[model samples]
Target: MDDTDQIVLSVDGLQVLIDVLTADGYRVIGPTVREKAIVYDDVASVADLPRGWTDEQDGGRYRLVRRDDSALFGFAVGASSWKQFLHRPVVKLWRARRSKNSWQVVPEVPPVERLAFIGVRACELEAIKLQDQVLLEGEHPDSHYQARRDNVFVVAVNCAVAGGTCFCVSMSTGPKAESGYDLALTEISDGEEGTVFVAEAGSGRGRSLLAKLPHRPASAADRQSAKAVSERTAASMGREMRSDDLHELLHRNLDHPHWDAVAQRCLTCGNCTMVCPTCFCTTVEDASDLTGKEASRTRRWDSCFTIDFSYLHGGSVRTSGGARYRQWLTHKLATWFDQFGTSGCVGCGRCITWCPVGIDITAEVEAIRDSEAD
Candidate 1:
């Protein structure tokens, strides 16, 4: 909130910000149009952004359409999150080889890359914070995650247009970014002056970067414009998750008939977990050469929806689709609070948009609550 942290950047000034980050040796990953979707990818300049494009999203549907004007950060949350960079899908844990008489082992070292993430939404920022808690501050901290997370910088974008599947307002995580970002940007256009970015520095590094960019001190009007945009986005959210006693509701409804109802429609495709920004389950695989002379262990992303994910000595624990679906919802909304002191869901609504059958979590939670009310 410092006066020095507030600034207004022209639409063209975005390229300067990217240049500064790149000059600082940070690999800038930002939103770009690819395969008809806005995805996070390597960005070099403003030209790489999805200009004049916004996305339409609903249950089990997503499409990019032309916007009324050229707004770089016009789209909502996409399938990919910053998690893909920090918590990699596949990582080699260690490699071992047979020695003359014994065995030699070599631990996998973490990669070295300085990453600067751009266009991170408020909900996505919360998801990253949750991952930090699980992978960095947990009892058994993951060194690989820590290494990648430590060197990364965040550039958060406040939502100006809420997608049809968005529910971050109800989750109290977004529409406007609060913290965890080095720099925060809010794009505002009155149609008369094209587009301008209202930027604020959240960290010392962010302040330094802002100093390097071609920016002017934000006016009182500029601040109000940004606030109005956030308010509009919050008011326009497509869904809402009632969190009052939500944990208890899920816990007591373990046997709720709604579980069976959703299970019948659920495909167990694991798309929800894959698209989720915060789901962090992983499994390890061990492989060796034909002669057994070399062996390597690699860790990869896994999903609770998978039957093999619950495999035990005899067979999978949660064999039924109903059981797996219940476990996922319960863990995500109920027990996760006990473990992480917060709900696992950020209400970004990726699971809803990406689900092939359009299974909506907010709707499911409401059905359970309504049933209890009955």
Candidate 2:
């Protein structure tokens, strides 16, 4: 963002922003300490933020650590993303009642929820955009996802520190918030500065809302400091994967032996897909009460790792664990561009951290590339 439009917010001002957003009738959700992880949930005030807390993440590992400074939003992403709130793991479509040997369909009419999400990362923002392409923009768009996606407010945060599993820099997705946000915050803390957030407005609504907060025009020095934050983070990314012609690379390696290697390590537990920010596969489930008087339809998230996900008339496709693993990684880094005009991955690296066996997506692709060279 240009220095002319930049501004600064103190800790108290940050709390005011949250209060103002709530007063504007938005359910302000943000990162907080939950279950020893920084998860997104209802954040009523700045006090609810995970100050002085950061996370240590690696393949098949995650631990919460304390930072010397009380910098809110200092940590990287946890297991949860904003997808759960927007895409929703479970949705009730409708209910029905049987009256006089006839069934009457009952329509679900729930009040639309207006949500304001804070601490959304740049790659996570891209994940949301990818979901919009799949669920909101196509000819046969998903009405349920669209309904929840509308009228939402986004407050993006630029990374001041990189996670042990992060590779967003390799994907060219972020260390900074480029777009798809209302307000973007960069927390700059030092002994001289104590702690203050440099805020940038990305939309008209953001600018209007920012003008109401207790803030001062950000100086050029502050802008430089904020730029330094992303630079340091980008330089220190924990992992990387080459993206040039990646689609073709995976496509040609269908019979690659490395698939079997990964399959041996993969438990087909679907943990990666479950924690993924952009995986949108879902299955519809219908159930009836024992009384046979009421019935309901619901949509729940499904994964390619499940055997039943590819069930056909007689049997399941991709029967072997290798085939299932290949399908997932291939679709994420290769065929997703064919389907959505963008890579299915934003390189957040949750797949590696949350995998029980520490399956790294970058290493898998590199192995395929190395095999091609050999």
Which candidate number would show the highest lDDT if scored against the true structure? 2
Could you give candidate 2's per-residue lDDT for residues 1-374 as a string of tens digits? 56699999898888999999999999999999989998999999989999999999999999999999989988889999999999989988889999997899986654488899999999999999999999988898777777778878999999988999999998989989999999999999753656899999999999999999999889889899999999999998989999887999998999999999999999999999999999999998999999888999999999999999999999999899999999999999989988988899999989999999999999999998998888
**C-alpha root-mean-square deviation, each candidate:** 1.0, 1.3
Off by over 4 Å in 2: 99-102, 191-193
lDDT of 2 at 329: 97
Model 2 Cα shift for residue 369 (angstroms): 0.5
Q: What TM-score, computed on C-alpha atoms, does each candidate reach?
A: 0.98, 0.97
Candidate lDDT values, in order: 0.91, 0.92
Which regions in candidate 1 have their CA more than 4 angstroms from the true location? 190-192
- Per candidate, the number of residue pairs that clash is 0, 0
Candidate 1 clash figure, as a count? 0
Q: Candidate 2, after superposition: displacement of residue 365 in Å?
A: 0.4
lDDT of 1: 0.91
In model 1, pairs of residues that clash are: none
